[model samples]
Target: MPVPEPALSVRGVSHAFGRVQALDNVSLSVAPGSFTALLGVNGAGKTTLFSLITRLYDNVSGEIRVFGHDVRRRPGPALAALGVVFQSRALDRDLTVRQNLAYHAALHGLTRAQTWARTEGLVDRVGLTEQIDTPVSALSGGQARRAEIARALLHAPHLLLLDEATVGLDVRSRREVLGTVRELVAEENVGVLWATHLFDEIAPEDDAVVLHRGRVLATGTARDIARGGDLASAFLDMTGLEPAEGRL
Candidate 1:
């Protein structure tokens, strides 16, 4: 049998902003039913790569593929199989959770019946059934994040890309969000490429890519990268950041 395609693939990809090169021949892959952490600091080109993958910014060089479809050449099929939750909170604070999801589903060409069915189905999965009719502003931070995840899943995309998804949440909320995504990989066979600047967000068993200065420095399980020390120190070793600059 032929080998299964990677869930997400970026090969020889590069990007720049005027004079500053943001990404330099960066490449990585995420397998189905697995979680791969994109570990980098604030200016490490994580968001730049995300923008290219989502087609918010086209790639000037290299290629990006989702499953078997090239993002640029086959945008519809590529994007159809992908889900994204950006770092920014995208839910409308003025709209109820149910309304927000329904609107999004509709925009994706889901019929009225399909929209309602997915909304009801996802609310319970994301633990937002009771708050489904409440405005986003009324929900707690964790609840709001869960709502965003639900919105992303409304289309049933095979690969989920989350950019700093747990960034401003408390400990418990971060754990909850991580748990929710992990469950998707385990039960639904979804692939995840989660980008974050925090080391604690990465689990021991997770495959990890250490990116710095727009280049990949390492790729392995988080535990292997840590080498029994810790992810942070391992990053410090790779990026050559002074101890004082070591926020990751």
Candidate 2:
């Protein structure tokens, strides 16, 4: 049987900023309904790759395709098929939760009725139904983060990109968001690319790609990459860095 084409395909993608090379010939693919994690340390080009995928910054070489559509040549359609939750919260603090979601839906060209239905569904899914009308500034950090995730889903994108999404989140909040993401992958058949340094955020069955010094050092299932070692130690070994004291 022929292998199905990946929902997201990055081919020979490389990026640089003047004298500094942020990514060197990085390439990977996300299969349909797959949950893939990109693990790397600070300045490992993870953010650069994400920026190129989302077209936040244009790369000088290589190709990025979302669901077989090239991102640079067909940005609008490619972007429409993607849902992004950036490292920085992109919500309007002054807006009510519902209002923020409505704006996002509008940006995606959803009708008012469609927007309302999708907003209600996402709010319930993310467990923010009770705070639907509350101002973002009035919500707690976790609540705001949930709201942000819900907002990202307003357009029902096929590919979901989350960048350092669990940062500053308590365990309960982290679990809540991650669980919702997993559910989205299973139920909605969305491809998920979760970028973070923390291995605990990933499931054993999740696919992992390790980036070090602007290059992809390894790609495989999380358990396979770890191979009886803890993820932190495996990462350190692959990147040629010393493990922190007390870490297995």
Candidate 3:
């Protein structure tokens, strides 16, 4: 059988900041409906890669394509096909959950009727139905994070890019958000590029790319990289870092 085209593609992409080369010929692809994790340490150029893909920054070299459309040549369509959930909260703390979603919907060119329908579905999906009318500042941290996810989905994007999305959440909230992401991929057929450092965030069967020093060190199923041990240890080994000398 012929291979299916990737939903998102990055080829020979590289970027720089002054004397520091952030990305050095980095390349990867996200298959349709697949949940691919981008694993890296702090300042490993993960955020730089995200910025390039989202067109937040223009790279001087290489190609970025979304669903076969080149991001550099056709930015509008490429961006329209993507939904981004940044690490930081982007919602207005003073706005009601519903209102914040409405603003996002408007930006995505959704009509009033479509916005309301999408908002209701997302609010329910993210388990925020009860707090839909409450101001964002009144919600807990987890609730705010869920709201951000809901807002990102306002356009029904084909690809979702999450950057450290579960960083500060408690265990319960983290699982809740991750569960929502899994359901989205399974049900909506949306591809995901989840950038995170936590091993728990990657399911055993998921495909992942280990990035270190602005390069892809390994890419395969989590089990393949783990090689019978846990992913955290495998990751440490690949990055040339030794595990701490203490038992868990």
Candidate 4:
């Protein structure tokens, strides 16, 4: 049998703004049922790479593929098979949870019937069944985040790109969001590229990519990268940053 194509593939992709290079020959892949952590600081080119994948910024070099479809050549299908949750909250505060999802479904060209079915299922999946009729403004931060995630999955995208999905939530909420996505990987066979600066968000079994100064510094399982030490120390070591007081 032929080998399956990666769910998400970034090949030799690079981007720049004027004289500042934002990404340098960056490449990575995420397979179905896999969770890959994109480890990087604020200016580490994570957003630049995501913009290229989502076609927000055109790639000046290299190629991006979503589940065998080239993002540039087959943008329609490529985008259709991909879901994204940006760092910023995207929910409409005035709209009810169900209404927000319905609008997104319409944008995706889902029929009224399809929209209802998906909305019901996704709301339940994201643990928002009871809050489906609640206005986004009435929900807590974590609840709003869950609703946004449900909207992103409305199209049943095979690959999910979450940029700092758990930013403002408390510990319990953060764990809940992370666990929900991890469950999707196993139960729905979705691939995830979770971009975040939070080391604790990464689990030991996860595959990880370290981006520093607009380039990839390391790639391995989260545990391998940590090497029995904590992720903080490992990250500092890999990026050649001095450990404070000889410790992380």
Candidate 5:
């Protein structure tokens, strides 16, 4: 049998902004139902990579594909197979959770009934049942984040890209959000690319791709990349940094 195509494929992708090279020949792949962490420090090109994958910028040097559809040549279907939650908060503050999800569902061309059904389903799935009727501004940070996650899943995309999804939440909230996403991967078979700089966010079981200064430095299971040592130690060795607190 032929090998199956990856859920997401980035090949030789490079990007530049004037004199600054934001990304340099970056490449990675994500498999279906798997959780892959894109680990990098601030200004290490994590957001740049996400921007390229989402086509927020113009043409780049390499190719990107979602579920076998080239992002440039067949953008519509390719995009339809992908979902994203950026580091920024994107919820409409004035809208209720249901309202926000419904708006996004409509954007994907869901009919009234389909929209309502999916809204309810995702709200329950993301554990926002109690806050479904609350406006985004009234919800807590974690609640709003959950709502956004629900909105991203509203389209039922095959792959989900979360850029620093747990940036500001407390430890409990972070754990909840991370656990919820992992559950989705196992139960819904949704592929995930979770981008974060925090080493604690990556579990040992997760597949990891370490991005350092716009290039991929390592790729393997988290433990393998850590080389049987703690992730922090491995990180320092790979990046050639001296021991220090509060660094990547």
Candidate 6:
């Protein structure tokens, strides 16, 4: 049997803005139906890589593929197979959760029935059946984030990419939100590329990539990347931030 193609494949990717290089020869792959964490700090080029992969900015060098379709050369198929939830919320604060999802579904060219069906299915899946009619502005931060994830999945993309998904939520919210996504991978077999600076968001067995200063420094399971010590310790050591990498 031939090896299965990864759900997301990025190779030799690099990007720059004038003299500032945002990414440098970055490469990583996300296995189908698995979760891969892109671990990096604030200036580690995580967002730049996301921007390139999502086509928010064109990738001038290297290649990105979704389910075997090249992102640069075959954007349609490549993009059709991917879903994204950026660090910033995309739901309209004024619109009800139902309205926000319906509007976005329309943008994906989903018909009324299709939109309704997916929304109904996902509302319960995201634990927002009651909040479906609630305005986004009225919902809690975690609820809103879940709504955004629902919108991203409205198109039924094969792969999901979330950038710092739990950024501002409280501990319980973050756990619930992250747990929801992990369930999707197990039950629905959706592949996930989750980018975050919080090492706690990842598990010991998860496949991970460490990106620093626009470069990939390591790739392996979380425990492997952590080596003999803890993840935070290993990360600081790998990025040459030793001694002290954080300040209050």
In order, the Cα lDDT scores of the candidates are 0.92, 0.88, 0.90, 0.91, 0.89, 0.92
Write down the worst ten-residue block by lDDT for model 3: 239-248
Model 4: per-residue Cα lDDT over 1-248, one tens digit each: 98888999998998999999999999999988799999988788998898899999898799999999999998999999999998888888999999999999888889999999889999999899999999999999899999989999998999999998998899999999999999999999999999988888888999999998889988889999999998888898777766542232
Positional deviation of 158 in candidate 3, in angstroms? 1.1
Question: Model 6: per-residue lDDT, tens digit, 69-149?
Answer: 989999888888899999988889999999999998887788999998899999999999999999999999999999999
Candidate ranking (lDDT, best to worst) = 1, 6, 4, 3, 5, 2
Off by over 4 Å in 5: 242-248
TM-score of 2: 0.95
Error of 3 at 77 (Å): 0.6
Error of 4 at 198 (Å): 1.2
The TM-score of candidate 6 is 0.97
Q: Which ten residues in a row have the lowest lDDT in candidate 4?
A: 239-248
Per-residue CA lDDT of model 3 for 30-134, tens digit only, reads 999999999887678889999999899997799999998898999989989999998788899999999999999888889999998899999999999999999
Runs with alpha carbons beyond 4 Å of true place in candidate 6:
242-248
Residues 24-96 of candidate 1 have per-residue lDDT tens digits of 9999999988999999988899999999999999997999999989999998898889889998898899999
Question: lDDT tens digits, residues 1-248, model 2?
Answer: 98876878988988889889899999999998999999887788888898999999996799999988899999998999999998878899999999999999989999999998899889999999999999999998788888988988899888999988888899898888889999999999989999888778888899999988799998999999998887887888788876652122
Q: For every model shown, what is its TM-score relative to the native structure?
A: 0.96, 0.95, 0.95, 0.95, 0.96, 0.97
Error of 4 at 184 (Å): 0.2
Candidate 3 global lDDT: 0.90
Report model 4's TM-score to 2 decimal places: 0.95
Could you tell me how far off, in angstroms, the CA of residue 147 lies in candidate 3 after the best superposition? 0.7
lDDT of 5 at 110: 80
lDDT of 1: 0.92
